[model samples]
Every structure is written in C-alpha cells, then in structure tokens.
Target: MVAIEFPLPRTTVPPKTGPILPDVLRSEWDKLRTVRSTYWTLFAAAATMIGLSAILCGIYVAQYAHLSAKDRALFDPASFSLTGSFLAQLAIGVLGVLVITSEYGSGMIRSTFAAVPQRLTVLAAKAAVFAAVTLVVTTAASLAAFSVGQMILSSKGIGVGLGAPGVLRTVIGTGLYLAVLGLLALSLGTIIRKTAGAIAAVFGLVLVLPTIAGLLPGSLSSVQKFLPSNAGLALVTGSHAGKTVPSLAPWIGFGVFCLYAVAALAVAGVILVRRDA
Candidate 1:
C-alpha cells in the first residue's frame, strides 16, 4: 500500500471575545428597572428629599421672618436646616445599601454573575446605573426644594431666586452632593454585603464623623473641616471665609465627596473581582 502524505490543513486561532462594557451596562440598566426593590427605594429617596426639604424650608422661613435685611444678606437660611436632609440622607443611604445587598439576599447575585461572568463588569454596571439614577432624582429634589422653599420664603417676605448670586449654584450643588454620597454608600454596601454594617458605616461617614469633629476643641476644628461632610458641603456655598471655617474651598469640598466615592468603589471593585459572590 502506498501511503500518500496528505497536506495538513492550517488550523485557525479563535478570535478573542472580550467582555463588552456597553452591553453589560444595558443589561444592568434593565436589571435595575425590573427590580421592584430598586424602584421602591428610589421612590423613597425622591419623596423624602423633596417632601421633607419643603417642610423644613417652611419651618425655618417662618422662624426667620423677623430677620433684618442685613441678617438675610449674611445668611443662607434657605440652605440651612435642610435639617431634613440629615434624615433624608438616611433614606438615600438605605436605598443605596439595598441596591446591592438585596441581590445577595435573593441569591440573584449568582444569576447576575453567571450572565456577566466578568465580576468587575457587574460592579461597574451597578455603580453606573445607581449613580446616574441618584443624580437625576437628587437634582429634581434639590430644584423642587429650592422652588417650594423659595415660594414659602416669599410668603414670608424672603425673596431668593436662582439668580441670587450663589442661590442657583447652591441649589444644584447640594443635589450633586447627595447623589455622590449615595454612590459612596452603594460602594460600601457592595463590599460589606451586610445591610446593617453598610448602613452604620455610611451613617458614620456622613453624619457621625462630622459631628465628632465639630464638637472637638478649637485646636481640632481647623483640621476637621477637611472631613467629607464638612468640606464636601462647601460646594453648596458661595464662600467659606468666615472665622473658624474650613480651609477647603467649595470645589475642593466637593472633591472630598468624590474621593470618598472613588475610594469606596475601588475597594469594593477589588473585592468583587477577587471574591466569590
């Protein structure tokens, strides 16, 4: 038998099918919308932020009705005692915590991981969707607060509008601040996985730490202004030149909030990719 050597056909190398970020983003967005818990939380955030903001504004406006022109000029009473936001932030934080923890609670995280096996992709997707939603809702609430608050204040002969120098900026900036803070909470929850822990952590970061510093002796007050809540709040103000005020400028204050978000998300991203869901 003559054994003829057949020519070997060339083998083809498979093309690299890397993960698509945009597709993952679309999938995540769909997940967010269909998820009932997410909707509820978002609704809660919007309602609390807008509703309580208006109420608080009304309360303070009524109290400040006796203010002289100079007192009004020197004060941003309209922004103060958003005192409601202190409580409203708790709602926003809870929503942020649930956004991730609920998935783990329902064991849906396994399905999410199976579909989008690239773990970091899932984390990134969640962050983007949650952050975007927060920004929109917060901006709306802030604007509503400004409008309704202004109307109530106007009823008390306190007229402040978007054109009132820093009024518009403050209105918008406070919204951005809350939204960023929400993302930070979400990032914290993603890493911790325990609702209580994340909630406590966020509260400590947002409220407790600032309070602690403010209560410190005069020696510490100067340095405490650099904390997330204190420094970050300046973004909503036109100036911070008052005595004993933060050395942090408005933009810099907002930057501190960004740093908190970035650091928390980075840690959570690392854990999500390296650890099992």
Candidate 2:
C-alpha cells in the first residue's frame, strides 16, 4: 500500500527591518534620563553657573574701587557672568564621561550593543541626546546668569546690554562652548571606556594643558590661543577694548575648538567599531 505523502511544510523568512534612528535616539534618551547621575550632574552645573556668576559679580561690584587700573581695565562684565563656566565645565565634563564609561563599568554596554548592533549609531545617539540636553540647560542657565549679573552690575552703572557689541555673542557662545565641551568629554569616554581615567584625561586636557602652555616662552606662549579651552573661551570672551584680547576671531576660534571635538569623535567611532564592547 502506498502511504499518502503530505506536502513539505513551507518555509518563510522574517521580514527585514529598516534603520530606526528615532528608536535608537529614544533608547539613548531613556537610558540617560533613567540614571540618577544625570539629574545630580545637571543640577550641579546649573547651580554653579548661576550661583558663581552672581557671587563673582558681587565681588567685582564691591571691589570696583579697590581694583588696580590694570585689573579694572581688563574686567569684562559679560565674561564675569560666564565665569561660572570654568567650574561648570568640570561638572559637565565629568558627567559626560560618566554617561558612557558607567555603561562600560557595569557591563551594560554589551547589552546596548546587542540591542543596537551599529556601535557608531549608538555613539551618535548618545552624543546627540546629551548635546541637546546640555545645550538647552546650559543656554538657559547662561542667559539667566548674564541677566542677573548685568542687573547687579547695573547697580554700579557698569552693566552692558545684551545688544552691546560682543555681549550677545559672549552670552550665547558660552552655552555653545559648554555643549561642545560635553561632546568632547563624551568622545573621550567612548575612547577610554573607563570612568576615572576618562575624567582625568578630559580634565587634564581642559585645565592643566592651558596652565602648562602658559609657562612657555612669550614667543611660544601664543600656542595657548590654540588650546581647546582657550579657543573655546574665545567664543564667550571675544576681544573687548579693555577685556579679553582674543588672538583669533570668535567664530574662528570656535571653529578650531570644534575641530578638536570632531577629530576625537571620528577616532572614537573608528576604535569603537574595531574593538569588542
């Protein structure tokens, strides 16, 4: 007897999925917001930016008459308001490094990569989310600080208008500078993959490098203008008759500073893909 033969079961392949950048961005954003460090770091940055600016402006107001002519001549009310950025940078930079390094430290990076196999995409999402958040928060804080400082200085008739030459640029450029600084730190974190080491490297580059460069001979000291912090600061403290004397144009210096961050990110993208998570 011939047994009835059943037809072979038909095989089917799963439908292919297209790239979903929004999903990646959403995931990165969720990861960033879920962590407590994000709130604490951002709070610290905001408080420092506003608090230090107010306090510093108060000191300047009180000491206006006592300051030597040379010191008085170089005082910039706009830059004074943004002075908090120096301290805020540490907070922003450290948090930026922690954003990625913490994942590596906790072995969560592997899971992230498993969920999103395109490593550079993951990096880009992180950078984009962090940069956007930083830009908003820092810009608001910068504007507030500037307004408050200007109001305080107005008490002494030394306040400048937002419309004043270089004033608006300094105020807005400060926020942009901080955003780029955060991106640079994030790139370094991606490359180093360790929290402490990455923080140290970033801080060293930002803080120590300028100090070291300052010690060079007068002829070579011009090199300091090209340093990342110096160049970035140029955007926020452009040349004023009696204040900061920027060697490069504000936009030019900012462009140079951007190059450093871009170069670091490009290198990080290459290393991230070539190595295991």
Candidate 3:
C-alpha cells in the first residue's frame, strides 16, 4: 500500500544562548533585594552615616569656641561630615560578605552554580549587583550627611558649600570608597566561602591591617597610607598631606585602593572556578 508518507515533524532544538550575564544580573538583584538582611544592613549603614554626621557636626558647633586656633584652622567641614563612613563601612562590608557567603552557608550556592554553570558569570553578577546597590545607597546617604552636617555647621558660620574646593569630591568619593569597600568584602567572602571568616578577613584588611601598619618602625610606618582603608579614606577626606601620615594624591590613593579590590576579585574568580561549591 503506497500510502502518502507525510514528512515527520522536525523537532528543532533551540539555539544555545552565548552569554547570560543580563539574566544572571537580574537574578542576583532579585536575590539581594528580597533578603531581610539586605534591608537591615543598608538601613544600618545609612543611619550611621547620616546620623553620626549630624551628631558630630552638632558637637563641633557646640564646642566651636573651646577649640584651639589650630584645631579650628585645620577643621575640614567636608571631611568632618563624612566621619560616619568609618562606622558605615563595617555595615556595608558585612552586607557584602553576606551577599555571597550566605548562599554558601545555606547550600544555595550549589543550586546557584548548578543553574548558572558559568561560575565566573555568577561571581561577576554578584559583584556588579552589590556594587551598584551599595554605590547608590551610600552616595545618597553621603549627600544627606553632607547636607545636614553642613547646615548644622553653618549655624556656627563654619559650613562649606558644595561649591567649596574639594567639598563635592569628598562627598562623592565617600560613596565610591564605600562601594569599592563592599566589593572588596565580596571578594573576600567569595574566597573564604564562610560568613564569619569572610567578615573577619574583610575587617582585618580594612581595620586591623592599618593598625598593624601603624605599629611598624618609623621608616616603615609610611606603609599605612598605602593600605586599603587608608588609601580609600584619602579620597574621601581629600587630604594629600597633613600632620597625619602623608597621603597619596586623592585619585592616586583611590586607584591603589581599587587595585587591591580588583586583585582580590581576580583571585576569588580563580578559586571559585577551581573549587567545588
């Protein structure tokens, strides 16, 4: 029987997608924004930055007359307004560490790796998402802190406007410093893969290392300025040279700080690819 043979339906396989970076980024953003810790940490950072700035500015206004002439002369309203960044860094750093380490702690990382397969893409997405959020939030907090602090300072006739030399740079650099600091913490978290260990490592680099550097012999003490926190702070504080350990130029110091984060992130990517989740 010569039955008309109809061609069998061809099942065409869909073309494989090359890069999933956008999808991965969206996933990472969703994960980050949905977590309770994310909101709490971000709130803590913003609160500390703006609240402490206001408090410090108020104190200075009250104590303005008691200060020595040199103290008054050395008073940098811009730098003083950002004093909260010291504490804010810890909160932001913890958030950064948690961003990756929490997944590892909960064994979600395995699922994440299974889903993405491209480990480097996962890592890059996490860094990019976290960095972007951190920059926006911290920058807004910094601007608020600067504005509030300067308003308080103005009551004492000591406020510097945004147009003042280095005021705008310091305000913006504070955010950049915090964002990069968060990236550094994320890299540490990726490398360590443990929440506590990664946090300790982050704080060690940011806080302890500078202290240790300070204890070096006088000739070696200059090394403090090159450390990550100190280097980043130079930009935020807008200090090139002063009674403190001489700082690198603002941009130079920030560049050195960024290199440290980049180097750590590179190591993290290598280890992430080589190690099992």
Clashes per model (N, Cα, C within 3 A): 0, 0, 0
Worst lDDT 10-window in candidate 2: 239-248
lDDT of each: 0.75, 0.90, 0.92
lDDT of 1 by residue, 44-120 (tens): 76677667767876776776858676666665644652435556667778878877888887898899888778888
lDDT of 3 by residue, 39-136 (tens): 99999999999999999999999999899988888889988988999999999999999999999999999999889999999999999999999999
Kindly report which residue stretches of model 2 are placed more than 4 angstroms away from their true locations once superposed: 1-16, 68-73, 242-246
Q: Residue-wise lDDT of candidate 2 within 1-277, one digit each (tens)?
A: 9776779555686664787688899999999999999999988998998999899899889988888878767778888888898999999999899989999999999999998898889999999999999999999999999998998898889898899888989989988999999999999999999999999999999999999988887688889899998898889878555643336779999999999999999999999999988
C-alpha TM-scores of all predictions: 0.84, 0.91, 0.93
Off by over 4 Å in 1: 1-19, 65-73, 81-83, 238-247
